[model samples]
Target: MTNKPKPVIGITSGDLNGIGIELIIKAFSDQRLLDFCTPVIFASNKVVNFYRKTVTESSFSFYHTREFDKINPKQVTIFNCWDEEVNITPGVLNETGGRYAVASLQAAIEAFKEKKIDGLVTAPLHKSNVQSESFSYTGHTPFLKDSFGAPDVVMMLCADNMRVALVTEHISVSAIAQHITAEAILSKLNIINSSLQKDFGISKPRIAVLGLNPHAGDEGLVGNEEQTIIAPAIKQAKNNGILAFGPYSADAFFARGQYEKFDAVLAMYHDQGLIPFKSLAVGEGVNFTAGLELVRTSPDHGVAFDIAGKDRADAGSFIQSIFFCADVINQRSEYADQRSNPMRKIAPDVVSRLADEKIEE
Candidate 1:
């Protein structure tokens, strides 16, 4: 029997007080999105309806489905997880909203694990609220990694055609120095390389590694981490036959569109990469969790509590998340097809696979 077209995407409604509902409403408003993949929202009909009334009374219709088999892409399909009545108050954080948001995420994750959904495109969830309601985790990336038992996971934020992968995430600036070791850097680089080749379809991805210090430690004049830690990691990555280069200065590297030269940049810290990345591609950036067992993507921006219900939230990033998810899904499908095809022959030494010894030792 032929396999059915499984392009169903699960979208988790973020915090009720945030722009999650607004963006979801706006993104699905476009009928063209249905042409690419079937979107299954893991939310409540009551919540979505109330959001529509508060934000845009466009008279759009949504079909409620309890199961994935009942999804119809031609119309908006919502999986009702909440059986009780919900009060949809935009721009207000409450216990009910927090619980509901966590429920939606859990439902989507279960569906993905069951193979009912092809990929997941999360809206935005308030970290504090989610932690209070559900199990405490670092962020979406770590949550997904733990959920799927993915050993190595990378958080990549992309905007304006520039992509950056975070080496150390969800930690303070002072803690980043201790976290920046040669082993950690090399491991992240491996994840980035595999993700680019498999999910991104980049045959030979040239990746740039950013230095942790100013002016790349001025060649050890300022700090020796560049020479001792970062440089050695890059050298090891190069020896592994990965096209990895540099420990470029974080400040001057982004100027003159230098980031465009490489496929992706490995940032040593969170703000060091995200500040410039967001500055260039704030509303349009898509935050992608690479090296996951399943495809997962989200809007680069966070919950905009200030303008949640004002109809002022831009859906650009949310829309970009959907598009990026679709793109990655297609890339993965194509790669799988190529691998299964008998006529296709992959080069033996093209991409080096890291052994257990390399990863552990």
Candidate 2:
């Protein structure tokens, strides 16, 4: 029997001015990463070399090529998206950084379209800098949702066994409550439940839904959204055969380490979930876009402009993102394979006859 081919993971060089390149170079320096998946960085050799100079300690080199067929599985390959000369500026955000960042991402998307990559691991990108008439989505999740025609997607932050999914992300605080209808919560619940099973391989995922108000509305004294909106959503989720529970008070639940008991937690908003996760996960957290056809993951931290060129940025999260992408890709493939030819159900009469034969014997 032959061994299965490794997954081709596409890595986008996000924001040349940021620490994304540093993290990428640092993560691949170990070389053992190439054994799990073939890494294809969607950036030019010149751009990668610019940051490679800062991380002089790492002896990471890449196979520079513009063609897809030239990608080396055993080595890192830089898929040059552009050939023109561009100025490099660390710790500064500019239009050029955003422009090239978009170029790298679009190139990776094209590779996905051609079925060249199995999964994608993106570096951090400044949301404001990348905004234009063509790309107007808040972050990668929305852009990918539109690109793939996904009806809905969940921005899931994962670290170790702890997973937190948000119902609303990158929106104003005032607008969060208005968006927290039962339908929206139930939709997120379904997506989170499905992802836990298919992406993470949880057989029966138990989802803990957090409340929208303090003390879960304290029996509707502080706010009624928990009782009126969130509770109803959890009920509807259970009706749909989802093991969903609670409009639990977010603060107390996390303080008491209640999340450890459940498979996943569904936060009402972005910060409500991320604050605790970032605090707990620190440098090892990974942001996974759940409910997408393609597997995409990113480091939980953003572009650290302060430490961009100082070589102080840790590659733990970025490396974790790579491993997470491979795990999800394999999990999805295995899950699909198991479902492809399911065992036929035994007929009632056949079962009864077998039972009677056993009894007679």
lDDT of 1 at 185: 92
| TM-score for each candidate, following the candidate numbering | 0.91, 0.94
lDDT tens readout by residue for model 2, 70-163: 8889999999999999998999999988888889999998899899999999998999899998889788999999989999999999998599
Runs in model 2 lying further than 4 Å from the true structure? 343-361
Give, for candidate 1, the lowest lDDT window spanning 10 residues: 342-351
Write the residue-wise lDDT of candidate 1 on 142-200 in tens digits. 88888889877899998767899999989977788999999999999999998898888
What is the alpha-carbon lDDT for the whole of candidate 1? Answer: 0.85
Pairs of colliding residues, candidate 1: none
